[model samples]
Target: MLQSTTGIERLVLVPSLLRSLLMYLQLQKRKDALACLKLWVCSGETLVVSLAKEFYNYFPENEYKLCNFYGSTEIMGDVTYHVITGMDQLRHQDKVPIGLPIDNTIIYILDSNYRPVKTGEIGELFAAGQNVAAGYVNGRDPEKFVENSLAIDPMFAKLYRTGDFAKLEKGTIFYEGRTDSQIKIRGHRVDLAEIEKAVTSIDGIGKAIVLCYQPGEINQALLAFVLTETNITEHQIEEALRQKLTSYMVPQVIILDSIPLLVNGKIDRQSLLKAYGNVNNNDISFQNGIDYKGVPKDQMHAAIALFETIASVLGKAARSTISIDANFYNIGGNSLNSIFTITALSDRGYHINISDFITAKDLGHILSKLSNDRKNAYLSGQTEHDYTSELLKDEYKEDVLDMITTSFYEKADLEQWLMPNIYVEDYRELIDAIWEPLVDKRLSLVVRAKNGEIHGVALNFDARDEPEVEIKSQLNIVFEFLESIEGPVRDNILPPGKGTVLHSFMMATRSTLTPGENVSIMNFMEDEVLKLAIERQFAGIFTTNTSPLTQQLGSDVYAYETIHDCQVNLYVASDNTKPFAKAPDSQRAKVQWKPV
Candidate 1:
């Protein structure tokens, strides 16, 4: 980050070299970042403390910084996680995050009456940001997005109402558990009450109540609390589940209990916690450590099998072999496979998390990360000394820029990163490229911003050319700016043409950037493009993903067939006699994403 007032900057190294530099920064005593290079050496998911001890030569992390991210499904994936500097607070009492929100994002911990609660009190986490996803559409009900209206902020455009819990820590965010019962373990979300209902419904179970407790001393192994009149052992329950449940849903334990609830009618969970507290996530097979070849070997058959498995699950074709290094997302991996992959790992005795592939370079890297994670889950927390770094106070919490790009047809080997070209100076040259697509029409351009300091410039390119423009214009301004950049736009940005790709030629600020800035510019740009598309009367419609710009579109300009892939995996108790059986399932949402 620019430590001075001058924010404009340039990168001189290649992306690979840049990665090396980043690794160095991460290793610095001051940079509080994890050593990802070291973390990737092994299979990188579902790791346990026991496995790390067995293999400390490879898996060594500062125990003090073992953070656990938490938030809601409605907001972005993570609102807060455990922190290195605050572990002492948690050991004494429940310590939550008071961390800084993401760039251009806001969080409002509101009370039931929709008002701000005291700093230390509990409330729902309400978030607002460009990172927020569109509202859920399972039914006709509008109760989900009703957390509150968008409250404008000085720096960010608006704040979203996250239905999760979070608190401020120093300046970073520390997350508590959710306001409701929604919980995600290793990235797989399951309702405890729902699981209990299913368990009780089984023939022999008289009553059941599922309880989730932090693994602490006397904490039962990561599992389910079952109360059944029939003397069914854990083995019997597990055997029953083998036929009916997906491996990920299985509980590690199925304890016999005489008392199912307390006098207050609540599940007597404290006694259970006291009985088997501090249970580790290691009771599963995936936590035992699995070895995988880092690179996809000449196993044409293995790649084919993987592709087939994924395709069968998603009903897509997999005749093509995916590169071992190819990302699942850039290639169009959706949420279905995201969930399916967890079950897939558990099917193989591997526990995994969603972040493992959030920007995974390729299948090989992900396979490696998953391998490590499995063997290292619930390792000793980071030590306090390790968390006392300058980087914690001021560090660039970087997220890999995984960009994907395509044209007309879907492309495999999804390898696009929206990056800057080495020589681009400004956005104008980028805009100039659009002129090529608009040469035939009497083109007029529109650039948006409050002042002449432009944020976006639209080349009202006319796409309707008879034979196409024979000669490209040297006067193209946008293309020149693009060519001057140190690197071109990363693959993640939209292609030049789209159903309608709306983007600022520059980084649009959360506040300064408004739909009005885009609409007026796009309106004129479309008029010019309409001349190119040869649709003189095409002023009535436009389409794009739901965003500030898209939200600005007239109510009639909406989307349809927004494909959502769904899946429901019935899990079982690994140590139980009749753990999981073919269980009832719920289709969560259509999956989105492909390996880029």
Candidate 2:
């Protein structure tokens, strides 16, 4: 019926409703009805780039223009306008600009002191113009309407504070957010709109809304509701945010199929919060939401217990679904909360090390690591096999070399920086150079399966008696990097003796083993090494862990004391190049030791 209407040259609608209409028109094959619509004015909320791109795709003729109108009721409707003639304007923008003020309307970006902010600085928006409304009828919030401090003309005598933050660059005004959106998190002030902008800027995110749940209380948490068009998980979004924002600024991301909206087209934030509260308020309803399709009957009891513990900890902050395939981090588990989950599980007689839990690909893998008997059976796959740690042997050299080459090239974190510059020959050469000393030290250990295949290797050396070998390959870069972080601790922190400190130089597991299996084997090797250290009357065992799995085991599971920690990305080599420059700030090399 609306398709027959005439004289529809312009349309003013909220961005959200416009998006729904555009999608509907395209789906209904009614694009021709919009031929008379020459302009679309979007206001009431920020128009994200994703929505703008949708509009651009729907109307490619360039005959129609999209304008962003910015204003409040006190400003007598829109006081600023910007027109998008083509997609080029949105290519580099996160949000559509509110643009220059309308004729006879004056806009000022001012700081808390009411002074004009410099160009590109964000401040509260204030407006003074002929269209400015007189004081409110009830005379409430009288401070909002005040005498214009910078007014020179009689028409600009009244100024209305918009209570919104914005910045101006080259005469174009960009909306920042509302001032009331700021809240304190862990003693640091965080802007929900800033977090929302970051989340929306991610490549596949269609929309995002960041809200604080239970503010000013002990259970307060910052939550981000994201609508994504891709298969990206909550963990991936949170990791991406960690790269762009500080640790405290990162919010727990919840992926959603659709966001609730009000009749006026704006997001219904209160409904979103209420829904979260409802999900957490009822335990039976929450438990029913978990997926248990793939869980084994034998492990069902333990899985349910673990799930309940996790639910108790995460509560309202969990992602949309919980299942055997879901990752702990992807389901609202952070490092701190992970510890809480672990402690809760321990109380219920379920046990798994932090490294195993942190590195598990999914909850099913974590469930396998909860018990030693089950872990060994799970790692061996079809048939259970007895694995044992044995001292270094001459006949196992070939198998050891193969494991080292594959593990270092494919899984080692530090070697990844050198990339194409590293080769299998480098590791072969490294093994050859150190082979003699490794055997003589009698400190190296390897884990062998029932089939006599070596799956894990740990090469150790006395802190003061280790032999020095000349390395001629790019693998030397890894050694140099290790020495730069490990040398100081050996020279100053550890005990000064050839037999007093056993330095764990290199440890690697087969490339085919799952992360949980790798941790199990490594744990066995570490235990055997400590026994050997105790037999030799050494004061302690010293090691440097670069991989995140080993780092967690050393610190959290094995109770090793950390002596020195170095950020891998911050290390500059002798060539003055940061080989690990692409590494995340959280990546580190930990020098740790456990006393005998």
Candidate 3:
């Protein structure tokens, strides 16, 4: 209808609409339709320099002009205008300038205090002119339309706070981004537009949009969606961003074949956020979004269960979709949350050791290690010895303390790092400090022989509710190292609140028993601990294994998963020295968990 009308010399549209129309015309070979238009006015959104070049290529710079109009409805449509007469205007520009004020409109780039910022300094764009709306309906948001503090004329007395940020350079205003787009991330004030610019500048990325998910929350994340022209992986984009942006400013990149757009041609940001939430949160509608490509037919059931469980635990905080090739850490799984994933998987009748999950290169690697069979055939006939596991009683307290002290001081691999600096008295003081709570919680277990001799002890506490004890001994170094590894896991990943996790703090066995006998006794004690967790309605058992024997049993024999492993010698104390420097490189402290 518009093409048939006479004297149609000018066209006005949003930048998105113009781009869409131009693409359609090029696709249909209908460049003649644009011939009637002498000029095109693009507004509402920032005009890409590339898009402007494309326009002139089709319409011919000699015949038509492209003008960028910048304004909002509250400012009576447009307050500033910039015209591009040829490709030369866009050659050296990073962004198309919003240009100078139109007619009687006055534009001011002001700081937070409403004072004019120096030229070239980015600030909020405030406008004062006859074009500015008097006020909103019912005086809503009266503060947005304030008195023009620097105005000397009646026409410029009222300034409309555009809420947009821009900078004036050499008599021209350049659009920056919305004021709300600037946010604090990990103590750094980040500009989302700046990140977006950096992303789009990378080769093969056609366009990019960056958005923050769950802003200001503990699990808050910045996500980047890129429309790419090549087979670029998300990891590659993230790595590129790390080089150009600050570490915290780097976002989880999600590559798209095509950027989703609304009917009016604007980027569908809400839809993008919703789709991300659905996939990450394990919403039933999007469960198929998980890729099971590398999974075997036999493991399909386990894969589905594991992937869905991981999604449920990670929820919207997950940075990427659950996929067979996705690394747990890259997809938002951490040591603490790995326990939550293990527990969730266990609930579904599938189990894997935390070590196996942690060490697995990808979800497919984890799937190969996943076991649906809960029966421990190897351990079936091993319990022939006459050892019974029971709760620790005050009668056995002195024996338990002695056993713990002797085992840790003489045989513990982790303490070997500190060796002579650590004392037997240190273990006694530590045992004394935790003795009260261990007795009260009733979670600790002890293995006793038929002759009433206590052979093993497993000190347990509620993971979320463990009491804070102050240690004056050098043993505090070990405790600090433990906290450095365990604190983040507990606070960030595990289910919040108490009663969900039973922390198997310290486990020790008497040196009197042979290695095989020690394994059997520890196995029995672990089973009893699992039973106790079930009886107490706790979700799982959390523990760290510094001894090779316990670490082996936790993963190979008792089915506890290893979530994280830290090299003993890598531990640096507050004194800025490697306290465990003498420890072998192979010696590691493995954080393990067993789901009830």
> What would the TM-scores of all predictions be?
0.24, 0.52, 0.52
Over 1-596, each residue of candidate 1 has an lDDT whose tens digit, in order, gives 31322332322221122223443454553332333332222111112222222222222444323333444455666553333322244443333334455556667776655677776676667776666655667644355555335464434344455545655544455445444554433223455544544454464554444565552111112355665557887556655653454443444445664554465333456887666443332332122221233445654444444443443332221112355655554332433344455445545444433344433466665555453244452131111210110101111111100100111011111000111111222223333333333333423232333443323222232122212322232223223222222113222332334323222221111122222222333333433333433433322222222122222221211222222222222222233322113222431222111111
lDDT of 1: 0.36
Candidate 2 global TM-score: 0.52
Give the candidates in order of TM-score, highest first.
Answer: 3, 2, 1
lDDT of 2 by residue, 1-596 (tens): 34835688899999878877886877877667677888899989888777887887888747879899999888889999999977888888877889999999999998766789999999889999988988789998898998887889999999899989999987799999997887755334568999988898898887789999986433456889988878999889988998898665688787888889898778999998887767648673253377778999999988987788877777765654678898876666654456567667877877776566766789999887776353442343422325788889888898899888877775577776675478778888889998988998789989996787789998999988989899998888888998888888899888886799999888877765543455557767877898899999999999998865567667756779999998999999899998889777877899998999
Ranking by lDDT: 2, 3, 1
lDDT values, one for every candidate: 0.36, 0.80, 0.78
Per-candidate clashes come to 149, 0, 4
Task: Give the clashing pairs for model 2.
Answer: none
Give all candidate RMSDs, comma-separated: 28.1, 14.4, 18.0
Q: Single out the weakest 10-residue window by summed lDDT for candidate 2.
A: 376-385
Which regions in candidate 2 have their CA more than 4 angstroms from the true location?
Answer: 1-5, 29-31, 230-247, 255-257, 284-313, 318-596
The residue-by-residue lDDT of candidate 3 on 1-596, one tens digit each, is: 22534588898888767866776777777667757888899987789887898798788876789999899989998999999999888889888999999999999999867889999898889999998999999999997999987999999999999989999998999999997787655324578999988998888786788998766443466889987768888889888887897555678888876778887667898888878766626373133356777778988998999888887766665666688898876666543356567667878988775545655678988887778665532222333546788787778888887888867776566665564467778888898888888888888888988888889998989998888899998788888999989888777867678999888888777765542345456656777888899999998888888765466557755677888888988888788998888666877888877777
